[model samples]
Target: MTGSITIALDAMGGDDGPRTVIGGAAIALHRRPDMRFVMFGEEAAVRPLLDAHPEVDKASTFHHCDITVRMDDKPSQALRRGRRHSSMWKAIEAVKTGEADVCVSAGNTGALMAMAKVCLHTLADIDRPAIAAIWPTMRGESVVLDVGATIGADSKLLVDFAVMGGAMVRALYGIERPTVGLLNIGVEEVKGLEEVRAAGRMMREHDMKSIDYRGFVEGDDVGRGTVDVVVTEGFSGNIALKMAEGTARQIGEYLRSAMRRTWMSRLGYLLARSAFEHLREKMDPSNSNGGIFLGLNGIVIKSHGGTDADGFASAVELGYDMVRSSLLQKIVNDLNRFHTSDVPAVPAEQ
Candidate 1:
């Protein structure tokens, strides 16, 4: 792997625009000195921010583009208007041309994914692209895919997510043959949608070396870290992800309210302030901000548009880690190997 990594930024994509994007770049540069950034946006807005952070400015190259893909813009509208000129489009183009190791954007999800698919294209042997997120679990973290790339994945597509997520975990966690689980309603053999069950049986029946398929996993199993990788179709996976985020917020709110209800409780909170701080750090969404678009020829990370500089930094850091891990080449190699083998399907249930 290369010691130095270059990242392209869609400076105009996020809610707070260039300031948020550049601030995040500065924070990430502090952590990774070997990193470089190429910022695409209006020079008038971006240059001053870059100038404020001279260190980041020194490491960054600016490309002026005033056009931006609106947050409400449809995928088709973005493609038509943002084809070659918009900051988001140009940032993705940098990856397609090998100018950057990865592209980081806090943009509209549909627009970003649509542009990425058009620019980077899907890898060989992969039918549809999957979006993978680093889910914070009880056992540290697990990789979950198809978080909302496409809806209604078939059995083979689910298996594809397994392979892709396994490769991602292996790259990030340095684990060989990371355990894989298909997210289901229950762990029973006969439960869940037909596609999930079929995928589970296929993984169980096949002798795939890339991942250790660990059968079915429930929604609760995700945070419990039942497996290193969780595979589900887009619709369910997206809902699960949002629900988890909402649940985390609810728990935090409850904790704060309880801590302030009485003088005695307030004193107790003061005594346990450090522990609470640690818990907050652990639960911070910013610390785990990037959602990766896997199964593409290049790496594309979508950050939460409303997140602050710290959150955006987390996204940039994710992109850096992926580049350092040789993520693209690893996925390509895994797919090539997977396609070469004859993976037979499981028989129909009586």
Candidate 2:
């Protein structure tokens, strides 16, 4: 469990660079003493931070990727002209060669996706790789997918996405009998255009192995966690996710400002310190940092661009959880089950 798991971090590809990247790396290593981070970035900046920290066992164990791929680099050009020794590319290569089990990046989303899909390729029988994030709600969290991965997913492709997303929710969160939904404009069964209606109908009738394709869900129902998994094409999913994240930040800032208004309010905040901290930690976007690039041949999690040490730590823990959970094997088993017709309407957990 300790040495068995290796995670590649894109040390040079974040908003804050080494300050936040290495700072967060320290916290991540401190939290999980057993984990090993193969940091890939400018060695000069990264090594000093690792040298200062005694808790991080193998901090010097880094791969120097002198060329950093910027967030604004065009996806196609980045792949065409980007440095061969860049951290992002090396990280993906590590997973491909089995030197690492998972790769985590706070880099360019499009670039990372392209590198992964182009380098690692999609799993057999799977159409495309999708970026999925867990939306926390009253019940727990629901998986939302194609978060800007594929633009125009056909009806059959979305049906495959539903199954893939359902498998992801089950592997990552241990959700058995996970309900699947196709995100649409309206809640009614036949309100959407041909593809949406067709997807809904396929979800109902399609024998999607372990996935219990529940039905269609509306935009507002995503954060509500109405179903275990929400499936949609890349265009709609990305817009909804960005909007939700922006709203969370706005409200969080308001809460902080209101708490600092007066002496009395500040005193009240002190009294409720623990609860406040807990809420803040829970609501922090960094804590929800890891996004699984589902349907890929291997695991790759892309952290947010603004992620700090705490966010990186969360990503590392997620990487560990993914490794320990044996997600790839679970998905493999699911694929086998699908082909052998071992899956029922609600397939039992393996």
| 67-100 per-residue lDDT for model 1 (tens digits) | 8999999999999999999999999999999899
Regions of model 2 farther than 4 Å from truth: 1-3, 57-60, 256-273, 339-350
lDDT of 1: 0.92
Q: CA lDDT of 44 in candidate 2?
A: 86
Residue 181 accuracy (lDDT) in model 2: 84
Off-target runs (Cα >4 Å) in candidate 1 are none
TM agreement with the true structure for every prediction? 0.98, 0.89
What C-alpha lDDT, on a 0 to 100 scale, does residue 136 get in candidate 2? Answer: 80
Error of 1 at 111 (Å): 0.5
Per-candidate clashes come to 0, 1
What lDDT would each prediction earn against the true structure? 0.92, 0.79
